[model samples]
Target: MHTTQTFRHVSYLWDEAKALELAGNEVDLFIYRSNLLGADLRLTNYAGGNTSVKITETDPLTGQPVEVMWVKGSGGDIGTLTKAGCANLYVDRLKALKNRYRGLEFEDEMVELFNHCLFDPKCAAPSIDTPLHGLLPYKHIDHLHPDALIAIAASKDGETIMKEIWGDQLAWIPWQRPGFDLGLQLEKAVTDNPNLRGIILGGHGLFTWGSTSYESYINTLEVIEQASEYLNANYGKKRAVFGGQKLENTDAETRKARAAELIPTLRGLASSYRRMLGHFTDDARVLEFVNSNDLDKLAPLGTSCPDHFLRTKIRPLVLEPADTLILKSAEELKTYLVEQFEAYRADYAAYYERCKHDNSPAMRDPNPVVILWPQVGMFTFSKDKQTARVASEFYINAINVMKGAEAVSEYVGLPEQEAFDIEYWLLEEAKLQRMPKPKSLSGRIAFVTGGTGGIGKAICEVLLQNGACVVAADRDRLDDVQTELRRQYGKDSTITAAIDVTSTDVIAESLKQSALQFGGVDIVVNCAGLSISKPLADHTEKDWDILQDVLVKGQFLVTQKAVEILRKQKLDGDIVNIASKNALFAGPNNVGYGTAKAAQLHMSRLLAAELGPEKIRVNTVNPDAVLRGSKIWESGWAEGRAKAYGIAMEDLPAHYAKRTLLNEEILPEDIAKAVLVFVDGSLGKSTGNVLNVDGGVAVAFVR
Candidate 1:
């Protein structure tokens, strides 16, 4: 148990006459008031903190007869105070006292006498920690138990815990009572370690001071953030718990056997009270906890912590063997609601009456949390995502904590009324109001092969912009691609892999690496391919094999591996193949290349039909004359093809452009954007469809 003390003192009684007298006598008081007013407006929770400044004065003309030292005034809750709450004391006098006693104990009476001796009788009482502030030689000091810092301090091993998380960038102090003794200890510690940056009082708060007030405050927040991360890593409560009972294999079989007996009642409750009970199905935890040694003895403790109240409620509904029917669960929920909310309603009415200057909705619903049944365990109820998420996180944390606490002692929580007050507090309610709506594909992942190539890179960029984290695979080194991506976006936005898509072994390794890197894959864009423009007579058997390996065989291997991952993870996936417009409209040269590309298109359509029942979408993009700078551009094939067609090298783009009805030069980026449409589910209700991004070239061929 800890003893709490309160300090209350009259610093300066505000009277117009005394104010006028002080205004005339000391110009410093006016300056201090102006500074205090400025700081108060910018800070949100200043009441929980303190600030101090050192003062130095000099002659305006001739620099002579100056007083210089640190002065700290009364400490009080800053939220409910005005400028007059602060005290002004002579810095030199406090320093002289410190020099005399060296390690003297400072009592409240001593602080009071010191303040009285420094200024006129009308001045405010010096703060209880005035002597402590006076002992520090720094120019500015600020202290606060900011919420971020409190979250860290409240954890076990918060000192070593914080140091490991934040490194040696911050200074830490063991917990101590706040007063002259604490001040003396700090002074000794600071003296021993001259390079101290800040002090973290374990299980208490933080302290930071700098050359300026703003710097001190910012530094305090920076240190607190370090502590918060440390706590979050080691002691973060679970976001939700498995509320249903644990089941043995035998018990699971028994539940299935008895399902025929319970199905009718379960179905009725689900149909009639879907809004209240959510979707409930018999799962393993439900069966195990139901068949546990004695659920009645353990279920009352509810979740492990306060956050659980938002989810699992304060307690779970327990059903005994004799009362396994859904009607019994419904009746129990009704009785609990009537008993709990009657008192809750009365208190809410009183609270509203007392604080009714502003008007909002009465409340979304008084019943945000619920327990389902004993055998079924707990279930949360919320009308919106915010309530649901909050409840989920709470229930998760609570369940873990409850289990841990139960091992040591009975699981206990704050009073029900206290929990209600926090749960319904206006400030907390505002937090729910500010939550962003969830995206449709929030948890989905994707992969893009040949990601370093022009078309592949384009697909990857577009996919990332929409929300999916893409794994970009290429045979080249991943360093340049990853660096470029980080420069364009930032680190970890897209992952990179060095892989030869044609090798079955390499494709398998790449998919494994991608899954480990990006959680899982929901989309695969097989953009990797090769082309060689050669007359049929000049084409070699090896050239055909190369084209087949890259264009057809490579895609087969990549898709085969991707499908295995998608099936194992039970993810609905999409595979978009990048075929060429030449596959649809044959040309005089490039026989092998055209044949392989055509085969790839037909294979994609077949895969689409095969994988459709499994909810995996497969499609292909046919693009023509996308002459962007890439591996093909570096090969000098465009110039050779132009010469073979009796056209100038510079005229090659226009020659191809004229073949399209639109006569537009297609770009790799255009094809990439089209690929994005299929990958993002924008081409709704259409898979196995080969969308052409070829500037109307296919239409010209048909005409």
Candidate 2:
């Protein structure tokens, strides 16, 4: 093991005053310690480390203090973990399970036996690492996959290197899949050396501990900082890193532009089995490695640590496009990737065949989760935005591990069969099986213009609830709405951006953000519009041009630009234009708004016809008299309509409802619901169609 407070590479974020405040509260302090360790990726990747503290708790039945271990639960990230996410188990019971441990093969049964040791029934389920912490004698324990430690852990002479760094204070152990047996090994290794600070798990990660939570936290960072300093020194001594850079860096703008163009196609190919969202980055570290001569050689050898290997797959697919970040054409690009994907699947199948045990789960999706293009940055794909981002981050960690290992010593990855076994582990398969069923719009991405407005916000919320990631685009950014939605639906669910729909350049930038933000747009809602209720006599050229520019030309430009990405993805898509009932029904003092809406309605049909052959669906939802919670209504359109009808402004809802065949009041949510029907796959076969949400207005019914 490598153990310090002073460091150059890692941050010392511990708050002494806060620590003093939490001193008496062990569990909260433990959580604080865990959060600090997880806050920095250098300590561990997201969802990649486990921390624990053992404390005496009053036994409900006996009224006696009993030793209980609190550890991070399965499927929880340490950075965001709370008390609710911790599993509490009787330490004595966990230790007693050793008698029932039949053998190494029977370690599979230990996970089930963990239930017998639960100290709290409602606590989150214990992770497989529970025993790792519970079995140790220390009051606090932290097992982390820090990049600097991993770099040494991944080297061929990792154990010898550990001895060189910490000599007698820290210990070393060979690689073993974590479970009861590995936990036992940890306990014995520490038991044999009472003064040891920690142990290095070869080709895996580091294990550090202390008699106190704060001590454990500091020890973990000290070890990482020492290793980081060592690696930095060695890297400085090297003539070059990663056998020297082989490719030149592309300019940021060209690289980003090319990344956006290819991301949709990359997403299309990655969605070979099921759709996966993508994340792209050109972080300095990522650029350095991808542009290295060793990238092709090191990439195929795969990630060394099990956590890194699990998320990124054993190895990433390396694509050799032109050094300029340009491909010959879309057709050729697809053909080349199709072949590459097929080859990757075959390789994965062969790996599974060679490593399967009698009870191995059937092979998972064989497509590569991480892709490397030399001049371009890395692309990572998964079922959601956060996961994709984490995967990419993990790959970058892997890259750093390789860089460190190669800079000082030869890098090593897990044995192919070992990686396969871990990937297909029956326990992992069960965890995956326990995951909740995907929501209706799961794996779908959406772009909503005017998304901060009442109707648009409702649509974004509904889509988020149904599992779609959304990009909320408006003429100006809605900072509060974005922050609130991210807080509610998770940071991955939606992003907010300002866009001018009338400018092709702005619309193009919006689509680029969409591609980068959430792979590509799967659905688009043209809901940004303002109403000018004026008669032909009152309507001026400015009124007509502004109305046409925003309502008609704006929707056209947004759709036209977004379609380029939709086509590149080669995936089914939907566009919902929010036309009004005024487009169909003649009303006094509504010429500008009605005429522009009519043009918008026809444009949907026109786009549907043009894009239908590419599996893109364009539709319109005509919402009439949505007086409540509508921006247009709030912006005087309601007062204008009330005056034209000779009624009170507040009475517009009743007036419009009375005019409807069903005497029903229309609302922004009703319009939002109408938009959902078009994109939720329930009406997959119906496109180039109009759905009138006017509470049964006879004149506005679509033909």
Candidate 3:
């Protein structure tokens, strides 16, 4: 509640026209749109930050030069800003002295300052720190909480913590209130250190200002880049042991039991918040954290940043129940409210009174944002769609950071009252009611073979959006696939396994591990088949064996093993085989591949016949010319096959395209979706059928 405010002159202000001129000539947004040479710059180079410019114009009525500030609004990362994201504010009004502030209360001053603000009236409230940006004297200013700054801020004793690493080059400040106070503090710090390149606010973020917007933005990134490099080199080993321990314990039964208990609570929370959130409970981090011994200690540590309190309450409700019933959970929450808050009932009433506006409904029940049951895990609550999503993201990120911190040291979170203060802050509360609408397939599960391949990877993304847990398996040990999947789907929702599909043992193990991790598997898309382009005369015994093993034998092995679990669970499961157009029509030098694919087609028919009684459908998707960037293309299979057929590889694709009525290059994903149709139960009674996903390549040819 300290209320001292200060301002500084940047000493290099430019007019609006000059600002626009600078933006047009040097901003990457203009460059990217103009198809200019700098478009290839890394997209993240300037993300999660903002740039602003000040324009002074004479008000026709007032006879005064009114300074209007144009600042980048929220939602976009600064590195990727375009023209539309810049918000225009009444700068002169923003910088105006408080009318009755000579002896005004803090709350009154805040109310008055907020009332006169005229920026992005339609959007959620302008950033809470708008006052900080207004007071900077520079025409253009840039700010970023880059990963490097977060790394330093996240550490214990971050000021002394950073000094050991950054030397004396970087300036540091203790954490403080972000708006008028932060701006004033920064002004003083800069004055004290006139040559200061940047300021790092311990536990808050980083700020870099300059004569122009671009220089400030670039310098912020450069400073963060240096910090990142230093951190990577110096303190990177801090969590190595913890990470290793977590990984080593991944498959332990104790971990699984803990995970199972947590999943139901998470699922209940997700289901309750279904309208507002995307797929939330299925993320791997949630799964992993719930199963850990430190979940109770970990959950709160991972909550959203100070800004996230409005969307999610300060801390999720931790339901350490002796029983698993919802009634018990409710009782536990009530008890916790009393135990945790000295004047729980009064505070709840006061909170509602403060937040309720003229027509706004009474605040929803004072349930916790998330709940952690004893053996059952955690649950998150939201009255509507947007709050749920915000809660979910906040929870996920918080848990991840906490888990990460726990690896290096004990993760003691911010005091509960402080968290409450931030969560109830007016600016943050608005975000809680603005959660994103839920997505389709918000909590389904999918298993994909060849997920490391481009086509398979694309399909995985589509399934993820539709709310499916994805298990991506590949024959190669490309850990990059796992890393990328985790990046997109959260570690829990995506599981990667290395398996040679031809080996029944490997397939069985992979299936077992997946079932154990995700309760059960619902959809299976078989994309593990391979082909060898070799003429009938030149086809070696070894080549034929390899082709038959992967394309034919492997398919049978995987399907047979998964069938038992699918049937036992009574899940009307679907299986889609990636067949080849060559299975229907001959392609020169594809003697071994074509024969194996034909065998796979026949096998799909036989499996359909056998499994139909159990309501487990089987089908095949035959695709042609899906060789782009695949092993087939990279290894010159299409070129070799075309050469044997006295044609060019480029012409080979066209020849197949013309054979098909649509004349399109059949992508591997096209085949995957056709397989998905059967897996998704779209083909109700259409088991054992071969769906041509080859863009009509097989239409002209008769069996």
Candidate 4:
């Protein structure tokens, strides 16, 4: 064991903070180093860990020096820890708040007291574990659920093994749900072992403290390094023992094709609930673990630590190996995935029933947070993409921990009751309760062709408003569209691409970029079209070609590329083509535009029938007179149509509106909504259908 430790003095990260005089040198140094600790995924992941420093400052109210602990505040990641992310709490008040607990059964009451103990009302909510940090007598404290240390601490003989590894230098505290009682217990343990440098909370995480921020941070790394070395020596170096069989003739494209054939069934099953969203990953180590023959035995052992249960649940939903899937046909494969999901849900319900005690909260949604597919790797499900990504990271880390622990002994996870306690613990439950209700199409990604145009931009806006990340693609002027979309939906949620929908190469590249940014698209809106109103005899071949390329050919190429991405993601998808009412009702000198739209209508029906087996639905929306806000009307098309009617350009919109039986002015927003009715899957069993947005255009009604 490389346990002989050396302390290194870390350099200043906030040299500018001292120069700017933004904060005291000590406070700024603490903030800078805390971010470094948070950035290391091996140490702690995605806001799951926290750091704190004790500082004495004169109280403005009392003109007396008081000790305050500046801890990482709630809902803040340590990787981006700012001075504002630290919650300044009075240590004496926090200690006094503990005496008022009175052994309350409900956890929220204790959380309320922690809030009252905060010295600065402007400070963000302190971490729930603030009490534990406060009770320990140290100038600086760091707490992390580092995977290496957690693997050793999460096993059945974790305390015994930790003692043998570190001797009396490290103290062991048995598993306790994080709250007031746990804080009191930790305080007692520290008092009993006055000379201890750090402590390990069984099935939870590790804690290290020192007289300065650098000392505490380096101490954390050294102990984690030692734990890694210990595991490597005892359990075989570099996870060599857990290597598994790799698929023959399998490459990245092959895996993606297999996913398209396999994942839609899983996605279909998961998306049966409006709240569930799915994500797929073929990350190298995850693929190896899922392909391993021993996965059946090891996968169900649960998360590496108790903290992870809130994110991943106790165990993942595991399917049969990829080799088994390869032998089945597409239909057979889908049936098999559905059966596995059904079995997983039933098993989850049974586990919840068994784990429930009288005082325990109701069982969670019973959906597996992580789904382990054999050859295809893993699919993680959550309410949205951000949560799914976080859960995915946690599960991957858990796999690493399990592999290391397996090398030492048969790895053990926390028992059923304890897992339930943490999963339903009020602090964790509060986090979920704080989340806003998801929008109807939340977690779904949509791609809109001609997205810079009036109706197309409206479609993109509606989708973003309903919580879908949008990729807005257009042939030109995309930078302006990008600005509007970013202003409305945030830069992270909106992507803009310049592409000619008529070109397959450009379409493919744009779809690829969309997938790279936001997983894969669930909805494809084909809104790129053009109008060339001319009499059949007088219309030039160039007029016919231009209209066909922008409408018929453009819609075809964009839909084909989107379908490829949708199939690869193996998720339910919608393709809504915006066809004009001119397809249903012929008007004078409209042959070129009408013929192209009519061809699009028939194409939608044909594609719908072909793609339905893959669970991809195709539909069309027709609008008669959306002249009020359509770029198609503003850009010379309306003027040409008015000339055919022998009317002024200003009278065109009113003339078209009056032609409708209801005399309602159709806006681009109206057409966008009509497309959404089919795209959002609200009409679950309806497809190959045309929805009309022109208010009472009886002539344009489907014949």
List the candidates ranked by lDDT, beginning with the highest.
2, 4, 3, 1
Q: lDDT of model 2 at residue 520?
A: 90
lDDT per residue (tens digit) for residues 428-499 in model 4: 677778878877788788899888888988999988888888888987778888887888777656778878
| Best candidate according to TM-score | 2
Tens-place lDDT per residue, model 3, 339-392, is: 643343345556667655564544554545555444333344443323445456
- Model 3 per-residue lDDT at 409: 38
lDDT of 3: 0.57
Worst 10 residues of 3 by lDDT: 34-43
Order of the predicted models by TM-score, top scorer first? 2, 4, 3, 1
For candidate 2, the per-residue lDDT at 553 reads 92
TM-score of 4: 0.79
Per-residue alpha-carbon lDDT of candidate 2 for residues 1-703, written as tens digits (9 for 90 to 100)? 2122567888788888888888799999999999988898899999997999999999998999999999999989998889999999999999999999998888889999999999998999998888899899999999999999999999998878888899988888889988999899999998899899999998899999988887898888889989998898899476689888898988888778888888898898889889899999988898898888788789889998999999999789888854533535666777887888889989988888888888888788888999888777889999888889999999999999999998778899999988987888888999999999988899999999989888888889989988999999986547988999999999888899888888888888888988887789899999998998876788889989999999999998898888888888888999999998887888899888988988998988998999898989999999888776678887867878888999998788888899999999987888888888888889999889988999898877766
- As for TM-score, the candidate ahead, 3 or 4, is 4
lDDT (CA) for every model shown? 0.57, 0.88, 0.57, 0.78
Q: Write the per-residue lDDT of candidate 1 for residues 1-703, one digit (tens) a residue.
A: 1122221210112234444455532334433432342233222132334556666555344565444333334434444444455665556666666544433333333554565435334555565456556667676665554434433443444555556656665566664435566667677767877676666654345566776543454455456555434334433243212232343334433433333233223222222212221222244434444445535655555532233344455455444352334345655744544454455445445544544434343443433244334443333434322343334334434433333333322334444554454455443455567656533333345678889888788877777666566788998857888788867855546668878978888887677555444434678889887778888888899989988998899889999988876664444678899998877877767799889988998999899999998888998898887787556655656866775698887887888889778889988889878877886667756789888888887542422
TM-score of each: 0.50, 0.97, 0.51, 0.79
Backbone N/Cα/C clashes per model: 24, 1, 22, 1
